[model samples]
Target: MSIEVNNESGYAVDEAEFAALARHVLDAMHVHPQTDLAIMLVGTDVMSELHVQWMDEPGPTDVLSFPMDELRPGRPGDVTPAGLLGDVVLCPEVAARQARDAGHSTAEELLLLTTHGILHLLGYDHAEPEEEKEMFALQRQLLLTFLATR
Candidate 1:
């Protein structure tokens, strides 16, 4: 698994552990070994800017996923070897707040966001009622299954 991670925040974040966890999550979802994923850990300032620029929101969010392509149901019978899954931008400050609210560690919160972002890259959307139910259900299921092994 080739994961290109960028920690833009000043906070001391765990790089190796998070990378391993991300790889584990993608592997659990049956992503290709060559699938390219990039993650950026940013501060609230950058997150706010991104939220406005990308999502047209005015505040920071815990996570944002920018998927390059609509994920199909399965790998094609004759598929190309190369794949770019796109990026997931995570804000540590927001994650910390959410962690406290959820009564979990910051790392755990980030893990949840990471998995959530991956699901988005896989064409999972929680916008509509049915979509929200299916997307969140799969997210919870994946998180539970992957975390149980660790």
Candidate 2:
């Protein structure tokens, strides 16, 4: 997988960790080895613009996903085809505030957001109750398993 992380948020973050976490998630989901992904960390202003432009939301959100290939998770014996997975845009400022409310570090919140965004790229959504439950459960499971390796 080719995972690129671009930090334009002007905030100090572990870019390598983001790439590693993305790799872990993609590998666990059995995505093809040649798959490509991009993670962008941007400021509130840019995030706000993107939020309104893409999601039609009013303010800066924590993370946003723009999927390119619309790939789904693959089974143990079947890996996803090689393609551009998507771009996951993150706002550190928003994540920090949410982290304070959630009583965790900004890094942890970002990691969770990264996982959530990747799930969205993998065609998982939470617009409905059951979808939310399934998506959140898988998100928790993937995050916990990744954390265990640290």
Candidate 3:
């Protein structure tokens, strides 16, 4: 898998570490070995614009996912899978602020956002309470497992 991370926000972040987190998220979801992902650590300005334009919210979000593949048309066993996932835009600045509020390091917060975004690429959604529970539980488990090995 190719996990490309671009730090375009001019923030002091460790690209290699974030890349590892991204890879771990993809692996946790059983994405194809050849799957490619591009991650951008953007500033609040960019994130705010995206939030307003795409989601109709007016604040910077920690992360946003844009999946390239469409949902399978039928039952899982009856349809072919599309191997291409899409891009994830992460705001490290927003993540850092959230981290401060959540009482964790920025790295930990980024890992959470990474897993959440990758899960979205894998057709996971958190629009409801049960869905949020399942998605967040998996994300937390995977992130904890990844951190445990490091």
Candidate 4:
């Protein structure tokens, strides 16, 4: 897989770690090895604009996903084909505040948000209660497993 991370949030972030987390999530989902992914960290103003434009929300959000190929998770034996997965946009400023409330480091919160965003790219959602349960469970599992390997 080809994962790229661009940090324009005006905050210092470990770009390599975001790439690694994305890779881990995609690999665990059996996505194609040649699939391309982009992770962008933007400022609150940019995020707020995107939120209103895309989601029609009013404020900045922690993360947003724009899927290019609309690829779904693949089984172990049937991996996804090579394609552009999508872009996972993150707001470090919002994540930092959420991190403080959640009692964790900004990096950890960003990692979780990154995982959540990638899952969205893979067609996972939490709009419904059942969907929320399943998605959150899988998100937690993926995040914990990835952290374990690190």
Most lDDT-accurate candidate: 2
Residue-wise C-alpha lDDT for candidate 4, range 1-150, written one tens digit per residue: 789999998999989989988989999999999999999999999999999999999999999999999999999989998999999999999999999999999999999999999999999999999999999999999999999999
- Model 1: lowest-lDDT 10 consecutive positions: 72-81
Runs of candidate 4 with Cα error greater than 4 angstroms are none
The Cα error of candidate 2 at residue 17, in Å, is: 0.6
Clashes per candidate (backbone, < 3 Å): 0, 0, 0, 1
Go through the candidates in order and give each one's C-alpha lDDT. Answer: 0.82, 0.96, 0.80, 0.96
Residue 63 in candidate 1 has what lDDT?
Answer: 96
lDDT of 3 by residue, 1-150 (tens): 778888888878778877888777666555656677778889999999999999999999999998887432224234334356778899989989999999999888887888788778778889999999998898889888888978
Identify the runs in model 1 with alpha carbons over 4 angstroms from their true place. Answer: 73-81
Candidate 3 — which pairs collide? none
For candidate 4, the TM-score is 0.98
Off by over 4 Å in 3: 71-82
Q: Per-residue lDDT for 1-150 in model 2, tens only?
A: 799999999999999999999999999999998999999999999999999999899999999999999999998989999999999999999999999999999999999999999999999999999999999999999899999998
Name the runs in model 2 displaced over 4 angstroms: none
What value of lDDT does candidate 3 attain over all alpha carbons? 0.80
